[model samples]
Target: MLKPILKLLALCAFCWAFFASADVLTVRQDAPERYVVKKGDTLWDISALYLSEPWRWPQLWRMNPQIDNPHLIFPGDVLKLVYGPDGRPMLVRDNRVVRLSPRTRVTDTRPDAVTTLPLAMIRPFLTHDKLMTAEQLNGQPYILGASSNVKNATEGHILYARGELEPGKGYAIYRRGKAYIDPETKDELGHELNLVATSRAFRAGNAANNEPASLQVMDARREIRQGDVVLPSIDGEALPAYFHMSRPELAVEGLIIDTTSNLREFSKWDIVIINRGTNEQLQPGNMLNIVRPSPTVVDGNDGKPVYLEDSSRYQRLARNFGHEQITMPREMVGHLMVFKVADRASYAIVTDTFRPVRVGDHIISP
Candidate 1:
């Protein structure tokens, strides 16, 4: 009897230590008893309703066997709260399907079908913008002039460009902007691009010495000017394949290089590029946290190092020449999810911004 009791006590102590070492998933106090899935809803949006930390959705999923896969939930699926064998709250589906038999049915309603996310929100970004490396875009075809040499070219305009243009092939026009560099190593990663327009050559190709090829603007997002680059147009559906969300399997860290609008400060729904890429094991759907580094400061009382914000009191005491500056702790400003990935860089849109994100903001694993 004494031996059995000793073994039981040891097992209890081991279980306590293991549980304490892991994160405790916190549920919302006022979590809904049931949530009906909607067409425009995403996993992130639905998870937020029941979990305090929506990023830890995998934890909630483990407790519920009914919600085997999030991708299977349709628009009309009803998520009901249930208790697991362990007495923990679990989100289970109480699916209800209503079949419609119309006299002249023409289309498949697909009431049971589901989508990974709200495609409308990310559809614009799928084809419009891209970052290019020096070796990739250098010496490529470029717009040399516009009709009558105007500073800007709009729709229904003719543009002259020097390149080997096949008569029917379409080209995407891009305006190159600033070079995005790594904040830590200060290396040029890639050049920022603004897609201006796309056009197909109509007349003919121009030789190296002959007049440049003539093309008509088929679509215009902005001003297509002389000196803009002309590259092959990407298929509209290529990016949507990565729309399925998946957590990052590896740990990663980096900093924001720039934004789609070229703004210094970032806002909600802004597309931003981060320095990390596939080389760092980054994948599409990997969520990251945006953080601001703490400011460095000096102590007023003694010639010692201190980490604090610059205040009026500190300004008066800074006349002393020996005060040392120290860096303060990092603070989270927002959260971002990677929707696209390249070799050394990836593009992410700000999903939740507690504060406006800026260039050079640190990106850390969530």
Candidate 2:
């Protein structure tokens, strides 16, 4: 179920103050006067149909307080665009209803309401990825062996692990992935626990007797091999039913440390890992702008290749000719919203991309 509608409204009100500029609402030129909410339509997708920036959805909802439970949107509901008293555009629900005697009308609505983004795209990251500190990585239980003394195991195989574990509980099998390092500070942020498979603890281990616990492989994304670490399955409760898109409360400057599936270049709808999280006060729903440094080139040169500030070749040529360097302004390539926050890193999904974003790109408050 989604959070209480009142809380969502309050969050929208709080974020309204942070808008960079106060311009009249910019509705799309092709915006429809009335739209019927359809199945599989997300709040963002619907908003994009009317507003230039879909993240301003909460703002659009806030304009019409007369509509009850506006955030609990359902399919078949009719949304009509009307002007408020101040001549500002607002979206109002126009569900046809009969005015019978004073009584609460009951109707069956799906428990899963329309949310901000497509849940299917982020479900795997929510279920499979877990960031771990060095200590936690070292302390996790690892696969000892498989049934019939096999070195590798797959689904339906019985595997043995050595560690303290609760019987009959589900756990995720993982292997240590790349360690994240801050591009600017060069500090080790954390390591990624790449999920391999899932298993249920059939028997708990006895540390005093040096006995290993047995597990039944319930599912496999790949072969569940010996030496793979086992960690508690990430809870589905982490998936919020609904959240408002907002900017981080604090000023945070960080880099895109990595991408999901080791992608060389990522665009809209892709998941990325950044080096700022709880440490930088990042929270779910916070939006960040992906920025790329503009190229710097030799001044007064025709078709010369772009050069870095510290390029030795540029330094040698500049010393001889005394030509100045021209640095272009940084440009924003994309926008992303944080959906999960860890200790020193966070998982964000790309919402918009003007150009392909890459690792090492900088992220700033939108």
RMSD of each: 6.3, 8.3
lDDT of candidate 1 over 249-338, digit per residue (tens) = 778778898777778897767888899888888877788888999787665556554455544564536646545455678999988888
Query: After superposing candidate 2, which stretches have Cα over 4 Å from the reference?
Result: 1-31, 36-40, 63-71, 74-77, 86-88, 95-108, 111-113, 234-238, 300-322
Q: Which predicted model would earn the best lDDT?
A: 2
- For model 2, how does the per-residue alpha-carbon lDDT over 2-92 read when each residue is reduced to its tens digit? 6678888878877785563364677899999999999888887788899877777787776454444455778888988888786677888
User: Which stretches of model 1 miss by more than 4 angstroms?
Assistant: 1-30, 37-40, 56-77, 83-90, 95-121, 146-151, 202-211, 239-242, 247-250, 261-268, 297-326, 353-358
Q: How many collisions per candidate?
A: 0, 0
Model 1 RMSD in angstroms: 6.3
lDDT of each: 0.75, 0.81
